[model samples]
Target: MKVNIPWVVGLTIAALGAAGLGGQTARVPGSDADPASCAAGSGRITIATGNSTGVYYVMGGALARLVNGHTDVRAGAAETGASVQNIRQLVAGDYDVAFSLADAADAAVRGTSPFGEPQKIRTLGRIYPNYTQIVVRADSGIRTVADFKGKTISTGSPLSGTEAIATKLIDAAGLDELDVNRQRLDLTKTVDGMKDGSIDGLVWSGGLPTSALTDLYTTLGSEDLRMIDPTPLLPEMKKKSAVYDTATIPKATYDLPADVPTIAVPNVLLVRDDMPANLACALTTLVYDNRQALGAAHPAGKDIRVDEADRTAPIRLHPGSERALAGLTSR
Candidate 1:
């Protein structure tokens, strides 16, 4: 369904440019800037991140630091349930922005998947792929993705993007959710459970070189831990969730048998529809303008660039974001 925008947005944005609007309350371009004012850094925005041990937490924190460092924007990242929760909080106006999987972002826009209705969200850009990380204890004999039958696996937190991807992958592998001991938990808890022998395997969707996965593997310190490639089931996965695609995690990451074949979903930085255009444009500009500085704070930040700010999949660009890109290209 198309969004119904009032005719006044144009005027609001034009005014924002004239008034030198800044921050969340800035006006949309072409419209009259709000006669009132928007303070640039009056409040701190809290980013709802994923499991503390996961990439979402790491990157979310990096994003907060990145935005804080370059603009008059102060921010912080907090551990959350990820995806579904992140989107919900963002729409609820609790989170200024979020780290979400492409599947979840599509679902949010289409009003499908776990959402009850359509939401007003816009994409900043698609970042790197979050590979479906299928990890198994070496002794578990899970050399193949299909070997997860009857095994205890932590798919992901309830209604989480990871869980959504994990379930589809399981089904594509010809295994039903009921066929295995499906454990719903975050990455930290999943790792702890794996260490304690409570879980036989785990399927997580995250960026490459996750610090938590690194620590988990290092702490396990045995030949038994392995990253099982999932590309073998890609065709079937697509049938279930079109969001799935093929990607590879380099062998250098964990020193595995070879490069790991995996299923990946894009990541997005989302914002609410009601947000001020100038502020949204500013935030989008900051990500690309100060990308190098952001990268210095965290490796994930390096994934961002002016060249890729329009890369988010299956979602429309925000008008403000488009304006920002237009300004960049005009230079």
Candidate 2:
């Protein structure tokens, strides 16, 4: 049974140099220069997004369209390894904006492991939440994390928020990384593995109704696939980071028998601390103002609400984003 995933149609929508802004100064953020004086110049900018099948990629495309249609910024969304990598490249000036998981963003700003030194980054705003989806073959007899000791599992792409949470969840379950055969594959490959019985399970942190998983369920059905409740590790997960919370994946999301309980982490759109104030302001406003259009692309976009946009903490909001939000809420 072949399923057509609409989102993958134009996967590589635009290249980093697609907008042709060579030689000229790229609007790379993170400098001590006064953001107020920097004009919102007309040029191409890249957005670092996640796996092609994940919500970040879908929403990133939608965002790029919004920016292009409404502002002077010529935006392009690139598929990346997600959170950790996105933040790293965003700092290096490879990309102007990035979508990152809150926990990873917190680690980046605090100079924690996986990050060599503290980074100077600021949030456009908190967008949606990522629910940890742990799916196992019903025939694999993997009832809990402990059962994963001898089974093969896909832990998500390296340097991704999915990998970070997968590792923490395994540790919280009292299993060493050596206990399981870990595979670091992206969602597309992981789904392929699941289809062929080469992979026993997969741990993915993504938005509800992730296109890849939807494809998986559509092809494999409930008789062969199932999601596990990992809420038991919430206390342990929270001990390491306050950002960890519990969320439910409604049975309807993938047509399961019942709701699945899992760990949740908020996602944020990050930009360098030194981004021009006006550019940041315009981008932030464009997102909220065109919320309906973004939502039309993916359900996750609807979750990006104005009321919850400024909830990003630890990582300060960009001054321009703050100005945008201030004006938005006041009206």
Candidate 3:
């Protein structure tokens, strides 16, 4: 039941700095100084990612490595409660960058309920999508979200994006949170609960090939565990946020018996608006240019593409990111 973080996270990652991306002097918006020339002088930044078992954590580490290796920025990745908490802490200056679900990021920008006021956060870019995985015990007699009423379910850690989406999925199925026995636990505990029969099902939002979920299916066997189709509620979910889309959990993934229909939401890397432009530009450049290093770190990193970099609508692109991408485009 233990979900190991692929790599140890600490001060060491930040201390191992890399030379700036060697090239022309940078002309990013905030400064006339060449970004490459300032590599050694850039400040340290932390990337907030999700549970250890999830894609964000793995890729966040790869991204930190990219920045640490290609730019002057000293970066570290922190395991966090995902979207909601990542945004809150990022805005509070607890972290320099954060990985967030698009819906949660949209809510933060719109001054939604969880966000009391509109936040001044900006996106570096949209990376990949988090497929909503709902796995339940085959014998639990639950085939749909509606069947979750009065049943014990793990909604992921409190304040995590998984929790937010779990609640939404419940409502989308015309069920109320108050009617379900919700257990707010981390992936490890949730897996344990599932194995021990204390938990009926769980909701997880992560990139394909999530390690924890793989362990669950492997341990329980496909015949013992089944994935519920979330497609039935997609219409209702989309009504709440355009970020929701239908996605497939391929049969090859997790070795499921068949492809499972599910919902997915895009993920975005965010930073506060005031982040130094040069550093932001360098960070953005590192993420896109040396993405191979990131992909080597995690498969999800391969999905961080240039075409989707500017898809962060509603939330404006960070000036640094804008300047960085502009440099790429001009080239």
Candidate 4:
């Protein structure tokens, strides 16, 4: 039930530095001054992360610190709705790099629903898998996605990857948009709603041990809350997109009684296709080289492996990232 105070403090300082609100520079751990190895480009860049309490925000903060300390590029992380919004803003030139679910990125590249036309986006690489977590109030009498009818559910922030998945899950369960009372709220608000009994359930796609969910489980206790398994809709979900897979949320993550079965999606680091290759290459290098430091910020960071990094399919790997991977693998 204890919070990670150091990680919180680190994120705060990084946020302040990124916003230019701090007078003194805080030294980032594991930073280096080797410009040649740090890539050959220098500029200020911004990373689009997800809701404040999610893993994207934590990882993005770590990435910003890594970039600022080791590379010539000064970096900052902005909290957004995730995936759908990240890609939109990344292409709009609002962010230099972004975190997104593979499904949304694929939709962006193919110009699928939620996107009117093919987007000119590319990937740095795949980082980690996001587990789809659906939780309901134990007293709500909700047993499955089918029981969602007439129940108020938080489908995640508007235009977020969580919302996209939530929609797919609902449809796969043969429910219409109007069948359930859908509330489009961010993780923070969704947690509040669940606690207040104003919300019966929620659909969230995030890294394991999400701070917001952790707080919820800690405050509400198991007797008041329960996790639901949506793998029953997996075959239907895969028919729509191949990004989903079966995974488990170990009880240790939140001290539940047992592992929770769920669907999983890979998350990718994305950028515009026109980004300078040298800069992209540099950023990719920083991510892998500082994996340990990133993991220190969040356990999800350790899942970012070089071998699995270039697995971003459908969404083409950025040329710069390809070059960085090539160099990394050859060594």
Q: Each model's TM-score, in the order given?
A: 0.83, 0.91, 0.88, 0.89
Q: For candidate 1, which ten residues in a row score worst on lDDT?
A: 4-13
Off by over 4 Å in 4: 1-40
**Per-candidate local distance difference test:** 0.74, 0.86, 0.82, 0.86
Badly placed stretches (over 4 Å) of model 3 are 1-40, 329-331
Model 3 per-residue lDDT tens digits across residues 1-331:
2222234364333243333423534222224345443232455667898887788888888777666665444567888878999999888877878999999999999999588999999998888788999999999999999999989999999999999999999998888789999999999899999999999999999988888888998899999998999998998988888888888999989888899999998899898987666667777777777767777887777777887788887788987788777776677
TM-score of structure candidate 3: 0.88
Q: Tell me model 4's lDDT, rounded to 2 decimals.
A: 0.86
Best by TM-score: 2
Question: Comparing 3 and 4 by TM-score, which wins?
Answer: 4
Highest-lDDT candidate: 4
Clashes of each: 18, 0, 3, 0
Residue range 148-180, candidate 1, lDDT tens digits: 898889989987888988887788888877898
Question: How much is 146 displaced in model 2, in angstroms?
Answer: 2.1
**How would you order the candidates by TM-score, starting with the best?**
2, 4, 3, 1
Query: What residue runs in model 2 are displaced by over 4 Å at the alpha carbon?
Result: 1-20, 24-40
